[model samples]
Target: MVTVPELEGTFIEVETLVEEADLSEGPAAVRGVLAELNISEDAFTTEQYTDAVIAHRSA
Candidate 1:
């Protein structure tokens, strides 16, 4: 499962693979998924997403 915390100024699409996969190999799988969707790590920061999530939860 992928957990993409929302950010105020950035948008990210979430996806899940139906095939069985090992959790230990999830990093590479996530990278592949991001690449497939053209997503970048620099697109959103932890602080930004944390703030967004907190604001959303409070609301």
Candidate 2:
């Protein structure tokens, strides 16, 4: 499961994968999670979000 840690100045988002699912299911899952969180698609790049998650965990 994916865990997106909270960032002080940014929205937190994450994508988790289940062994039974395929990669194609990722986008829709991400979109649904983002929608639920009210995050706009253009607000953060995949790379940026990834970095934030890493930084938060390491901190």
Candidate 3:
């Protein structure tokens, strides 16, 4: 688990592995699960957790 003051609450990382031919479906599939979990698309971020942690500690 990781905690960053810049973000609210805890974060959960989800990923899907897909073949190169079906690579486009990766994001869609993850978004589908996020939707079912009531998580908004606006909350999606591509920031690395390690970077967030480093910045948080620096502050």
* Sliding window of 10 residues with minimal summed lDDT for model 2: 1-10
Kindly provide the TM-score of model 3 when superposed on the true structure, using C-alpha atoms: 0.77
**Against the true structure, what is each candidate's TM-score?**
0.40, 0.52, 0.77
Q: Say which candidate scores most in lDDT.
A: 3
Clashing pairs in model 3, backbone N/Cα/C closer than 3 A: none
For model 3, state the Cα shift of residue 31 in Å.
0.4
Order the candidates by TM-score, highest first.
Answer: 3, 2, 1
Please, what is the whole-model Cα lDDT of each candidate in the order they appear? Answer: 0.60, 0.70, 0.84
Q: How accurate is candidate 1 locally (lDDT)?
A: 0.60
Please give the lDDT score for candidate 2. 0.70
Worst 10 residues of 3 by lDDT: 1-10
Off by over 4 Å in 3: 1-8
Q: Quote the lDDT for 45 in model 2.
A: 64
Candidate 1: list runs displaced more than 4 Å: 1-10, 13-22, 44-59
Model 1: per-residue Cα lDDT over 1-59, one tens digit each:
23554533545545455446565565677667777777776663445456768888898
TM-score of 1: 0.40
